[model samples]
Target: MGIFLTILKILGIVLASIVGLLLLIILLVLFVPVTYKVSGEYGDKIGGRVKVGWLFASATGNIKKTDDGMDGIAKLKVFGISIKKIRLMGHDDTEDKHKVKPKKEKKNKKSGTGKAPDERTETGNSQMSDLENDLVNSPVNGLKNNTGAADTTGINGNVRVGETGGKADSINGNESFDIDGESDINKEIDRIFGTGDETPEEDKTADENSGKTADEDVNKTADEDSEKEKVGIIEKLRLKALKILEKISGTKDKVLDKKDTLIRKKDHFIEFLDKPYTKNTIARGKKLLKKVFKNLLPRKGNANVLFGLKTPEKTGAMLGKVCMFYPLYHKWLHITPEFYEKKIEADLWFKGRIFIGSMAIPALFLVLSKDFKRTRNLAKKI
Candidate 1:
């Protein structure tokens, strides 16, 4: 009975200890400051607004109570970390109210003369030449000053103006009128020559237009005549060759313009050559060598002959003798620069070959032993 009582006391103590430990941990957690990240996922329904203080995390005080009673504000210090939530914070006033008016485009005056616009020209009608005056004074007769020719336009035939004689004027089967002083002389001329003025301004304009049209026609005829003078095939070829030669000359000039840059290319080449290699440089070097050797090999011819000509047994033996001393050509292109005291990094100061040599001693020794074993077998066979 005493043993049972002692066992019950021990169990009680264990339980109490566990409970005390749990309480302690909770108290410690409550006092310590902690950071929490609260994020929202894509939801079906719209959620209420969440507002924080200056930073969305620190001292956040949200007023969830919007226009409704369900809205509530929360001022939180999550694990001693000051954070608050402010709901009911509405949208911002971000739009501009005052609108700017667009500028109106000014209209340009018509190009042709229409009723001779009332522009105050210092040069008046008196200053105009006789022809201009005649054109202006001539009866409107349904024709603008600039509107080319008025005569020879109608269907019936020529008719005398102010005299009322024979049939009306006509041109291209269309009936027209006499714009000029349609005297008997004009009617006779029309009957004999089949030509009459339906409009005076139009007649004068016709003369002017005919003069311009004749000049343009003459120019077009000259151009057509020149084109008729055809060149032979050899001449055409010569012209094309000349053009090609001119293009080559232009390219040569451009190259000359950039001569200074090409002269300084060596400096940049040296800079690239001196740059140190990173961890992947050895692999990249092997790839470059492979590509170069691949290109050097014959493409359209036999590969065995191409490679065999360059490396016979004599060359291999020579290379082997060199390898005996240096093991291999694991250089930074074998033209590695020596850097004694140039304030460079300590790791890259030594030649790449030396570094490779130091690292590869064990591997090289293994390879050399293997080679020696092969050499012994060959000697025994001989």
Candidate 2:
């Protein structure tokens, strides 16, 4: 009975400890601010590192473009000690991809299961000798083996070079070897022509078609001229005048439409300026914008920048627009915009931090503002 009671007490203590640990973790997650820092440079590509830590753990990673998809690596640390690493964005393929491969060692020809150099040469020489022997035993090569000069007088066709007036005789049809400069070229040309006519048939056909095609073209041109003669000068003049009048009338109608549209736009803009809501709306927007910046934008920040636009007038106009936001950002933002040059070059570094928990009340106030609600409703009506 006493052992049972003691076991129960131990179990109760364990349960209470687990519950206390859970509560402590929940409180830490709710109250502890998760801090983050981001820093990088910008040129042709955008690259940066983001570090986020809550309580004791943090992650830092860079995401960039890749051939297949996004490629990134991150390190996770616990209590300031690296506990794990993310490879190729959570893939196991490691840094070995960039490592140089060791070259393969060339094997010795005399190694195990391979023939030595002397034996290999002996085998190659024996093979060549055997091939020569086989060729000598053949009937065709027997004559060459027994005689130095080749026998030309055979059954297929006799060149009869011993009797052809010091010239090779034609073999099989009119084919023969060129012993001298004047070969069977004339006979070959005659065979290709296959006729005794001075001019070839192909040239005769081409000449025949040439005159016929030229005559047909001239006839077509004459027919076109006769057809054009059927139309009177008065009819052509009337058609050209009609086309010109149509183009002029179309341009005049476009001009009148543009003038009417401009007049309507001018009158509408003037009426909008005279309304009382315009001034109220502008003032309300400025007030709301100030509140939003105070809540969302970090007041403490630093940046270095060089920027430009296409033209000097455009640069000045954009500069004024940028100043409407937190005016102090100009001090840290060493902004030099091109006034005369027309080129794009950017060198930028920005660093800032914002507390997510601190913006709660200001966000609520901005959302519940009477003017913001009225403005949204007015926009819907418009």
Candidate 3:
């Protein structure tokens, strides 16, 4: 019985120790912060480094430009000992570095290349035959032979002028088709004016009476044109007055619509401001943002910048907007802006700590709050 009691006491102590150890580990994981540093530069070259550390473990990575391309490397360490180091972009191949180069062969020009005359003659003859066959089978040569024309062009110098609408254009100064198309255009003009050779026999026979008919037709057309001009003038005036009235009515309606929209928007904004949920949401959001900025923003940083946006006014405006966050970063930043030049130069470094335990709980509460719920439900806001 004493042995059994002793064994039981030992088991109880062991179990308690295990439970305490687990609780300690959980607390450390939840409360321990992750520290990080970021650094970068520009102008001569672009480069940067990022380092993140937690307790005894840390990882560092850096990138920089090279003659070939961007090169990057990363390293992992634990307890001040490097566990792994590797090239993040590409591996350093050692085989090429250690390779042995072959000795260059020596050439003797004393024998004048040491080739047989028959072989050289055969190669030259083959090249000559190939050239002759190419010239015989060429498309430009075929065109010259078929057309028997001196204006045939080679493949490179194709000349084309402004001819379209299914009309063939001159190629390589060949104006035969262009002349045919122009003649066709002239024929069409003559036909439309009743001067072509295809004029009707009846029209030819009636030429004697054409003078009197033409005079009467001219008088009749003049009277008709004057009446049409008067009608067109009255129509244009009526259309102008109607268009003016329509424009006025349209403008009035647009003004009234805008006024009604403004009134409705004002009323809605008032109601939104009066809601208790909205006030609560704004207050909570402001508090959360303050906490986030306090913890997330770097405690120490310096930025030296020579910048311009092509004009002094634009450069000042940009700097003004960026300086709004001066209070958050405090006095660690050093910036120099150039309002004259268009070039940009900068060197920046920042370090910050993120305590997940401190930021997570408030964020979780905010997300689960009734105000957040009301805001998410559009019906409640409306």
Candidate 4:
């Protein structure tokens, strides 16, 4: 009997220690801070850091763009000891800078009055008409002079006048007097009006070269326009992708805000639980507990629980009712009892028996027993 009592005392101490350790772990998990800091550009620059913990902790990295490339560093620590460290370096293409020339303004020619110059024909009709009149009047004047010379020559022919008479007679004998005059007039007309004939080979070649150059210029302009259109399309796609990313980031920020609100609410509830109990505190606790449980538990026909435990006076009775009526409790006990109003006595042989039975017993069994794999296989079969 003495040995048995000693064993029970030792077991009680071990269970109490385990319960304290578990509570400490739970407190640490609930209270430890996890912080993050992010600052930098999206594409041209980027950097961030994240830290989790109070004592046994972990931290993460930062990366940023430089003039030449990318550089970064990351570190991990456990129990104030560096467990892992990493460094990163990379390169990216740099932007190109180009010199741009300013455009020159075109100058418009102006007349003496300062208005733009009027269009004028380079070949004047008045000058051409004057040239035609001179051509017509000169033929008549040459004919009159020839006839007068003929009359003089005839008069000299009768007298046999001198060397001048001899030259005039020789001109009349060698050629028809009218033929020479007509030949001179034809030559003058030909000089004034060019012959309607085929163009020269040099002029034709020059025209063909000009046409080819114009076609080449048109093709080059078309190619440049196509390239510009392609670039514009690429820019539009890039902008669209950026817009989508912005929308996703906005949604992520909204979710984070909601999560932060929930975390704050949890912290408030924990603080409230640490305060002394009173009528107002109990009422507020009831409300907070109902809200939390409503969120955690499934609702019945769109309605959460409308009732709560009134105070510590009724706590035992409420727990008893829950154990009696709750489906989970009935399943665990594998039995149902008739309704009754009798007081039920509950007793524990050890001080930490509740914690040992609920947590340590199952945990120790899993760690020590070799039946975990068999149990897992059986669960899978089920």
Candidate 5:
């Protein structure tokens, strides 16, 4: 009885250990999901728009924004992501260092009109000088304003032409204002520094000389007109020849279309007769028909030369043999009595028409006629 009690006690302790281990495993599974959620949230801050799929617990980091934009830093997941800072620089500072000082305004010189020239020249000179300095400092911006036709003098200053003590225009000194109401200095500088218009002027002079020469040839213009008329006549003849060739091609196309249609219809009729006939006899009939039809029918184009009984001699001979001996041909066709009777009737009707319209009387007349001597005389003249 004591041994049995000891066994029961040992079994109870073993069962209790098994339940405790199972509970511990369930707790670990639940805790693992929570740990994953926390790690994913931290990873969001460290890697902008990117996720670390399986990072070690010891690894991880954050990003910071600077004056310019966002900057990425080292984190445990990324280990080695790097970024650098940028700075912007410009050219105005160097340009201003090189500009010359503005010159002092000179006293006005007197002219016969009793007006002081200095009144016109003094302020305009200073303003123009300031503008030049500004253009030197910021060439790109100045160029934009000038090209856009915006006010391009120095800040709040107006620039006027023909009011300066500088060298005057050679042709018209101080006589007229510049077209753009600005100083003539720009135009003078362009004339001196920019490419001159010599080549374009030379081209215009040559064109004028050629025009004069063409006008001098006007007295003999009737001869030239006659030559042009001859050329036009040749072109018209060439075009007419091309049109004739095209018409021939169109006729060929029509002949081909007719031939293909007739061949397909004949094939269908042949197939209908085949089931009633022996294979060997049917094959022979089809072969003979194919050879005869090919010989008689036009091979190309729309117009059948054989239309309205117009076949050449070789075609006529093959067709003639087939029509004249059709009873013997039908023996080779080997069709049943009922089908053979119908086919023979159709062939007879077709042959009667052929002999009356194409072969018997008129063919005999042509054979017996004595017109060859006249035809030969006509050919000799040609």
Candidate 6:
């Protein structure tokens, strides 16, 4: 009996300690006055101030665009005591301005005729023109010289330069004539007409090789087309399966536009809950719950919410009628039913309370009980 009593006492002490810690945390959350103010334009400038309690801590910072980039300053304070201050200076705009002036001058020179051609350009152009003239004149001159010499010397005849009527048979057997120029012309002619005796065999072999390559290419292309068709069909089937799975699982692609807002076509909550319980459904539910809690929880000292509509008057009128008929709609939706303009903004401020204030205990109890009920209902459905 003594052992049992001792065990009960230990358990009671542990429970009381846990309860006391929880109360302490709750009190800190309620009493800590963390306040912040932020005002900024889209791209021009931004500034913010944050304060914790009356004199416990505070910080302030401001940044603005300069001619070059940006400049800013920040300061931190604890118990009204300045702990640190920092200043950031912008880049030197004078240097960039000087750099840009030279570029503009170069552009102006290029746009005008005052630009001088460098030596490299002049030399390259001269060399290229010289090479082109030589290439064009060499072939024509070679042909003209060869034709004149050939006409003077009949077939199977040899001509000696600076000598007239040189007979091919009369030339000394041991005499070595300079045939270099004539040989070059003959080679050029042969290259042009393909009249060499050995060329026909080479041409025939090349033709055969080309024909084989053409046939192989045709076969390879056909094979590749067939493989592509097969792959396309498989891809189509896989995509169709994925789409079907997505529809059945109530999962959708969430796309965010330039405004950083999700483009939701329909209510995802209704879609998710309507689907039967599955691993994907459960995962999606958890994701949805996380998003809900994140939005519900207070992240900073101040909160600002903005809503906009294309036709606010009509929508607000319809919503007002619904709320009039169904009072519970007002509890579920925490916004004004009548909207005068296309845009609405709300700012929320919180005042800290005692750790275990009169309202904190009941509020915490209600929150926990509601969460427990919701969890139990979800488990039953699953």
- Per-residue lDDT tens digits for candidate 1, residues 247-277, read 9999999999789677667565554444443
The sequence of per-residue lDDT tens digits that candidate 4 reaches over residues 1-382 is 9999999999999999999999988765544433333233332234434443344776666676666667776788888788897775553223123445678989988658543333233346567889887665441333224332322323113211122223323323443222333344445666787653657886799899999999999999999999999999999999999999999999999999999998977776665545443233445445555544434332211111122334544655665676666674332222222234332221111110012223333444454544444334433432
Ranking by TM-score: 3, 2, 6, 4, 1, 5
Model 6 CA deviation exceeding 4 Å by range: 1-55, 61-74, 84-360, 367-371, 378-382
Name model 2 segments beyond 4 Å from true. Answer: 1-5, 44-46, 63-72, 87-299, 326-334, 343-382
- Which candidate achieves the best lDDT against the true structure? 3
lDDT of 2 by residue, 15-34 (tens): 99999999887666545666
Segments of candidate 1 deviating more than 4 angstroms: 1-228, 231-240, 249-264, 267-382
Model 4 lDDT-worst window of ten: 346-355
What lDDT score goes with residue 360 in model 5?
Answer: 32
Per-model TM against the reference: 0.17, 0.36, 0.46, 0.23, 0.17, 0.28
Clash number for each model = 36, 0, 0, 0, 13, 3
Q: Roughly what TM-score does model 4 have, to 2 decimal places?
A: 0.23
Pairwise TM-score winner, candidates 5 and 6: 6
Tell me the spans in candidate 3 whose CA falls farther than 4 Å from its real position. 94-290, 309-330, 363-382
What TM-score would you give candidate 5 relative to the actual structure? 0.17
Model 4 clash pairs are none
Model 4 spans with C-alpha error above 4 angstroms: 41-46, 87-382
Give all candidates' CA lDDT scores.
0.46, 0.65, 0.78, 0.52, 0.46, 0.56
Q: Give one digit per residue, the lDDT tens place, for model 5 in 191-276.
A: 78875666888979999999988887874697899999999999999999999999999999999999998897777556544543
CA displacement after TM-score superposition, residue 44 of candidate 6 (Å): 17
On TM-score, the stronger of 3 and 4 is 3
